[model samples]
Target: MDRRLPVAVSFMAATIVAVLALPLELQLAVLITTPSAILWMGRTTVQHARAKEDNLRRISEIEQTINEIAGEELLLFQSRHPNRAETVGGRTGMSAVFATTLNSLLMLLVCVALFGGKHGLTAQILYFVFITAIALDLIMGAVQLNRYVYRRPPMILLEK
Candidate 1:
């Protein structure tokens, strides 16, 4: 897991709380800023990945040179890790499912809150329901984050 993920999640939670407390115009500004920040972070991640790939390519070239000088075959990292792609697809699929479920639940909650008002729901009750939904979402997010941050690699054993 990336070290920055936790910090980003915390930042998002803070932004949501701040938005909830701010005026309507300020909340709109903050909402805009949040996506901009996310885009900047994503661009940074892409640049970092590209730089790492370039460094790996250079290392591979040097390895090829050394192999040519010594008249021996040297295996590249990719050949040694041929199974890397196989392990990632399952996790990605599961994550997609999880995200979709969470989003559906949020939509259901919003619909309930909106429709309840038509049936003479009190303002406090609507507010409570909305806040409950947000709280549930945040708690679930924190739990998922904790699982990812503390997850151990497969076959890693701890001593008692």
Candidate 2:
């Protein structure tokens, strides 16, 4: 099981509780900030992915040079580190999907809050559901950011 899944789920739960418990102004702040943060994180993730790819390419080139000089298949970088050599799919699409879903949900809730006046049980329930959705999005964005920012480089790269 991917460890990040559990961490993301727990983070979502905590965010839901925290946001729901916050004052109206703070909740609004969160709603305002989340989209911007998602956009920034998406950009950062792309840049990080590009950098990682470039670094891997450089490592492969260096290994090839070393092998040529030694006149044999000495540094089998890919064979030795298959996991690191494997390419991961881009995450920009996922980020866009999450952002779009969160925005639509937020807009729906805003409409309800603005036009559907009179806070009854149903309205309250809708509000809760929307808040939960927003919290989930926030946690997912955090998870994505964490995945790129904190990943450990391949051990071979660290060997100088």
Estimate candidate 2's alpha-carbon lDDT, on a 0 to 1 scale: 0.50
Which candidate has the top score in TM-score?
Answer: 1
In terms of lDDT, the poorest run of 10 residues in model 1 is 144-153
Candidate 1: tens digits of C-alpha lDDT, residues 27-122? 546544554454344334333433443444455566777778888867556423453233222233334334433433443344334333333447
For model 2, how does the per-residue alpha-carbon lDDT over 1-160 read when each residue is reduced to its tens digit? 1233334334443544465566776765554454344344434444555565456556767788888899999999643565554442224333443444454345435433442333567755765666565546655654553354324346654555
What's the CA RMSD for each of the models? 14.5, 10.0
Candidate 1's C-alpha runs over 4 A off are 74-160
lDDT of 1 at 42: 39
For each candidate, what TM-score against the reference?
0.46, 0.44
